[model samples]
Target: MRKRYLITFGIVLFILVIDQVIKFWIKTSFAFDDPSVPLIGEWLQLNFVENQGMAFGTQLGGGMWGKLTLSIFRVVMIGAIIYYILKQIKKPDVKLEFLIVSAMVLAGAAGNLFDSMFYDFIFRDYFDPCISYNQVEGSGIFSECSYFGYTEMVEVRHRGFLFGNVVDMFQFNVIWPSWVPWLGGGQVFPAIWNVADFAISCGMILVLLRQKIYFPKEKTSKE
Candidate 1:
């Protein structure tokens, strides 16, 4: 049990730290909606964008209440997953893989939760300022900088508390054939995401890909 706890918590902390580092870099170094800088010659790019709603930059509803609801939902889901993992870990034959996946999920959720809950008070927009508000402040580590041609142009209106925006910065410029459905000759997987989002997706995808192994069926006595 001690070993399991250490491994699980370690994974979560490692992911959370690295995810925050990347997000902090993005928030302070680049301008908003700036042209995607090619990391792998158009294949992979770093495009900074803030998601105000769900993963992959999908919006749920408009206004503060909508965002509040989304944040609450995330909190509940994270709590449920953590509770389930804790209970399962107490079992003698708990699956290590499942535990790792759960840890990853928990880390990802917590990472995004941090942004949703406190980023507004910790960081300010460098390229774009709040159009509606006259002024705002940032107290984060990289809250001020001049790298990558970044200028403290406009401070975005502070959303406050559980209304902060999720920072995302990875973009894959996937080229597809002209015959390929709606993606014809356009970038595939265009949704810009962050390290935390990637971690969550990876964990969930692994579970789906190996569901049979993680969840085995019991044999009947008659059989």
Candidate 2:
């Protein structure tokens, strides 16, 4: 069954769980706009930030409505990609690398989608800690200062849509060299991403570096 569709589905779901767990921790323990919670100094952190955009808060789009639309669009895209991956895996000349890469992509997308869809709506009640200035430091991106936190600290699943931003809490940065271009001499890596994002990056890079292993060069019509 290692070569079956179940393997791909199982792996993808596993990665998605890890991604959401980490995000849930960050959202529950910290506030947005926080650069670092000092997990291990400047090297490691549990920073909290939000994005109405794509993964890692990179691909920004329109307003809240726009983000909601994109979230729905992602479900459709991931569904299509999963279908393609399973179909390819069943082919006689299926490439293992391609199948895995597709799985990686689907997993990362699902992980982030969970937050954008139900996280803020239902899980919001859970993330909120003590409802006071001493506990949460009176900080939340939410507009209401009074209900900034849970009054009695409950964990009720909210009904309907919330459309809150996704949690991204990983920070890795590098100072660009002055001799480079556009962003030269600038600081980077404020992006707080999850493990699924890392998995997607690694999978894509591996596939690109070994392109011939997946799609070998085709002979010309002259051949």
Residue-level error in angstroms, candidate 2, position 107: 0.2
Model 1 TM-score, all chains together: 0.84
Whole-model Cα lDDT of every candidate shown, in order: 0.79, 0.66
Q: Give the runs in model 2 whose Cα sits over 4 Å from its true position.
A: 33-35, 38-41, 126-162, 177-185, 218-223
Error of 2 at 132 (Å): 19
TM for every model, in the order presented, reads 0.84, 0.73
Worst 10 residues of 1 by lDDT: 132-141
When summed lDDT is taken over every stretch of 10 residues in candidate 2, the lowest stretch is 131-140
Per residue, candidate 2 scores C-alpha lDDT tens digits across 117-179 of: 786565646443223211222222332333445433322212235355566777765567888
Report the C-alpha lDDT of model 1 over 100-138, residue by residue, as the tens digit: 998998999899989899887787444244322222334
What stretches of model 1 exceed 4 Å from their correct place?
124-158
